[model samples]
Target chain A: MNTWEIRFAMGNEAIAEGALAAGARFYAGYPITPSSEIAEIASRRLPQVGGVFIQMEDEIASIAAIIGASAAGKKSFTATSGPGVSLMQENLGVAVMSEIPCVIIDVQRSGPSTGLATKPAQGDVMQARWGTHGDHGIIALAPSSVQECYDLTIKAFDFSEKYRTPVYLMADEVIGHMREPYVLHEAAGLVSRKQPDPSEPGGDYKIFDFERYDDHIAPMPPYGGKYIFRMNGSMHDEAGFGCGASDNADKFIRHYEDKITKNRDDIVMTESYNMEDADYVLVSFGCSARSAMAAMRLARQEGEKVGVLKLMTLWPFPDKEVAAALKKAKAAVVPEMNLGQVASEVSRYNERKIPVIGVNRVDGSMITPYQILDALKGLYLKGLSLKGL
Target chain B: MKQRWEIIFSGVGGQGLLLSGNLLGAAVSVIEKRQAVMTCTYGTETRGTFTKSDVILSDGYIDFPEVLDADVVVSLAQIAYDRYVDVLKPKTLFLYNSNQVKEAPSPARQVGLPMEEMAAQAGAPAAVNIVALGILTALTKCVQPTSIQEMLTRHFKGRQDVLGANIKAFEAGLEEAGK
Candidate 1:
């Protein structure tokens, strides 16, 4: 619990320190590029804190081991790149359905089967939601700065523990490898899921309460605890028993969706810069937001009414906040490291019929502020021509 | 908002530009209590390919960490100079090593200084990056000269010779740039 310490560190180092600060007692992960630093740091530091660290044979085994550790009542996590995350998909799907508490780090690189290992791409934005296959709820946080890399890792763990689900920290290589001066704060407030009371009457213990699942998370009992139950991945009843009732299956999926979406007010967060009286709104996440901020500042200085909406939380898409920020703007320009993964989402979620333009760059080179300004300049002409200003 | 100092160090892999960027960032943010962000990106090349590091030194918080256009671009080799010459603004100060680079076809307002020769005279030819930092500090006055000296001493703690030679090279560069 070191506090008020200032040091120069990489983005990945900050994330590892953040996770350790959040009381993560177990780390089981395989090595991958741009993200191996998280595992390497955890290996050296976890033992000092009396935590367990293991390097499994492959990505699949690494995820499986963490899930088992979490079942045994340990705050666990694993770090991987695209290829490793792709390999951990099936187990990740299982974790999603079973509502296991774990944090997964996808330090994204160029993808589609062993692509550029060291180069960065935000190409996994869509994959983070749908990659696990079935219909389930997931919370993903995107950090743009080195400080947020630390802060958001704590947030990722908090959401996973509070909601009893797997969370993803979707960071690219630029944000993962970039170094800066960060003042380390006190340990974050750790959140652990509610466990069933061991002393409760045997007849009163219902581990998975179905109707209350919307507002109340089910109390999970550790494997060696007094309560006995099955941790099944398939469709199950309130007591964790196998069930073939069609109505019960209908209730299972609905509760999962409502539990997260009904609470999306707290789960989704966004950052808005100079949104008042803006003509063009720049929407971005992760490293792309940094360049967008710079471009927005430049446009303001030149007397152009441009603003930026940085999506700190990528999943559960902050629709209301985005619409509010762009209430006065004429259009939005989405700049992503990938080819408009979030841009497409913005266009779909845009309720005001505000034209959404996407500025995409995927060559492992960053989309500079100059590029964002170019997109806004094009939009400025369209706005002027329509209004005859 | 006042513009922050945007600086770029460009060279081949072995010239220690990345460490130079780190030293500058540490000097400003750690000792001087100003905000700074230093970034570096490299390909698979070890010695010959283009490698660059950027340092954004600001008085307040930094929103953007990357520098697309730089106020100063230091070129340690001929290829780096040629690669960056076309991108320089008329106001940019393009600094090049006189011994390593020969020609600048465009009018880039460059000052060809013998940074390598200055390092050689300071008893450590490997300290060219520090010398370049010294020149930048002396010319721009973005940071105090003593702060960079303190950072260099802390960065090379165990090797006394490395520390002393880099200090001498940095002083020589500062003196030359002042003249």
Candidate 2:
């Protein structure tokens, strides 16, 4: 018997529902435009499911609260906008260094600093990658549609649990505010944090046991569990005590980076549309991918062989898939709300030396299909000129 | 049936433009089992400012949510009519509230209706947006009137008086378009 239900919902509502479906038990957040709906829904629905919801004084407190909740063995998450995300950066680092499992939903708005409170922008792509001022690896997922907003939020929780790290659901105002139809399905393949074995010896429980675990990820027991261990924000030894040794610092730092980099295959996801035997490629993520898809369809109608490579996983960047697409295409177009954030990444993988164009919009409006098609037409004209020579 | 239909409902804030768009979207997406995307743009203030909702109904996947080429455009305010009149294509069906906007020279096919007057006549002056929606339903036939009626019944479930007035307003709109 199928248990799916179809409903018309906004993207922000989908994210909140997705969290509930993924077994998120606690939510702490401050209201912000484009993302306030998530917090609103969570505040009302979390309690109905016997979960907890708290409206923090600010974004800093919000992140700190969720970190505290997750440390106590709850699947916790928070939602906010770009400015709020900027405020949460310090606490975000604490989650990273302490290796606490949590999810942060950043519904991006136009900004260098609250540039446009209610408008959508993809300016936070680089920020999500290196926002917290650390060399640590991060996992960020972009959702272009309401359905993805639902599906990827659950994936974010699963990744946070499996890897014991904070994951980002990088949404934009377009997806957050826009309403569309989506099906709610029973979540399968849910991952929870590995807990320390209760039957084993209780004393001297090394919280960061790299040597015992081949994957380098140690089981994280709750605060009130049998194993009492420390969670240090500073560089620490395997036993979680503050260690100032140079080599100890190196090992733990490398452990943090290697855990994600070594497991890239399991973490990264990308979608290919009309990419089979295409000469032109469009690389985009977040809301911009929708425009790319529309442009690809229009170009196809005009008999232009254009394809789209949508980045579902933003961080631990899909290097292999991007490099492969860039190598095959005659030319590439990177459309984004920001000016060339993801385009720079696409160009880095441009080993084929083909022309990589950037279609950008920051006027608080979406990058329309016509704008992207214009870029493709320019590339087509350039290709014709080269062929004539 | 048309493979795709892109419609825009534009007016000042508090005119129930977003509600009209939502009703149409829910009708097609949920009742008809088709795909629909509704995106609304408004200012920080809740009322007396320009507001527009773009609804795109498609038989296949909708890549871009905004209207690239509008099949039908409904304007209930002069600012909205002025904003979109020049951008419309010749084949586009442009609907306007004659009570608020003066007839403008345009290439697109134009249909003018007194939505405010129709709503008052329907005994629901606040439901001008529903009257406009009714006219849209009659002209486009994108979704069945019964589908929209089902949505209205669901939307105004508790308020019987409002529901009756809105149903009468919607019928008034459908009747005006038919004539």
Candidate 3:
């Protein structure tokens, strides 16, 4: 085990190093702008570390290759952008339904359809949650800085392996391409998948065991192991056989969501800055969170009683934390690259009906701190006017 | 020293703006044990296109990576200089290439160095970016000249000729700044 070493690194480089540190032994990805660096670094580093790096023909094949590699018992992952993720959505469902442990890095660019190839955007927040066809719980983490790009990628793998599902490290082009100083520390609290104990098993082992593990998560042994079981993508029984019975279908489908939701306490992560006596709250994630933090600091310097709630975990939505942050605030501001993907989500938890303003920009540039600070000032004055009434 | 310094290196692509920015960032963050963040912007086409690298160095945390207000702005091309000259803060130190940028009408305290001539005299005309970096370091003292020299040695380790030329270019830049 090596000690911590600090170095200046790009966020993509940090993420690549993070994946390697987290014991990722397989990478199959298609290169895209703003994300090509990860594939480039993985290509050089994985080979040196005796891991496999494959450049599949397309995004669909790249995701499928990773799913196959994960099932074969290698910690596997892939990196891509929006169009690439759009291609991988079908296979992403395969990982979700089959419960394969893998990591997918989406270095988001401006896009509905390749809108700006090399520019940064946080447009994929909602897509990361609901891109695939079915209703299933997903784990996605957004990194605000190069350091979080390193830390959260390791956590992404840990969550994936532990929950037996695909995980996303949702990085925008700004965070992905920007360079900063970060400490490379050995990954602690690393969790590998729970493989079945051959001695304690009955005649046949359940691949999707809902009984033994109260979390509805079962042991996932490698394919060549002595425990022979089917890995079904359809509505499946504990034995991995397809089941059409209405109750079994309902139970199995609910298990996918419950396994994650029941463990939300452990899964959801958030960071609150200056929230103790905050009158206005700035809620954001990914690169936009950096702007929000800057804006909050500026507002604080002016003594406006502002704070920031940065959501590290994008999916499973960190609802309780967000609600708590909004509970005490007079108004909430969401700054995102997209029009209002996360802003709409923030509005849902505004039970107080406080104004939730979104500082949106899709012009292939970052949402500046002044833009957010201006929005904060507007909300502050509006509060004053209401008090005057 | 100021608590934080925001610098922008603006030029056309293929001018090594990003490399210069990265070198400065590494020197400050790695050697000086401070914090630095650099974000770059460039068009899809690689060469002869608009490009800029924004570097922020702080003794404390840097929340926003991009340069909101530049303290030092280095422009190596007329296009680059023209784009930023009008928007500079009055306190900004605007450094430009004397050969490339002809006009300089701005509120900033401007210094036009013969960076291209310096690079040529240093025997690596392509190392004009290094010359600009040298001038930036000399003018601001943002990082120790020795630290940048160490980074240059490491950055161009395998190619001895390139290393020697860049080191000379950097020294030339430092000397020009003294003049």
Across residues A243-293, which tens digit of lDDT does each residue of candidate 2 receive?
999998888777778888888999999999888977889999988999999
Against the true structure, what is each candidate's TM-score? 0.91, 0.96, 0.97
Put down candidate 1 lDDT per residue, A280-349, tens digits, no spaces. Answer: 8899998899889888888878878788889989887887887786667778899998888898888776
> TM-score of chain B only, all predictions?
0.95, 0.98, 0.98
Q: Measured with DockQ on alpha carbons, how good is candidate 3?
A: 0.92
Off by over 4 Å in 1: A201-207, A210-214, A383-389, B1-3, B113-125, B157-169, B175-179
Worst lDDT 10-window in candidate 2 chain A:
A380-389
Minimal lDDT window, size 10, model 1 chain B = B103-112
Q: How does model 1 fare in lDDT? A: 0.84
* RMSD vs true structure, all candidates: 2.9, 2.0, 1.9
Q: Which of candidates 2 and 3 reaches a greater TM-score?
A: 3
Ranking by lDDT: 2, 3, 1
Inter-residue clash pairs, candidate 2:
none
Ranking by DockQ: 3, 2, 1
- Candidates' lDDT values, in order? 0.84, 0.91, 0.91
Question: How far off is residue A344 in model 2, in Å?
Answer: 1.1
Q: Interface root-mean-square deviation for each candidate?
A: 1.3, 0.7, 0.5
Give DockQ per model, in order.
0.61, 0.83, 0.92
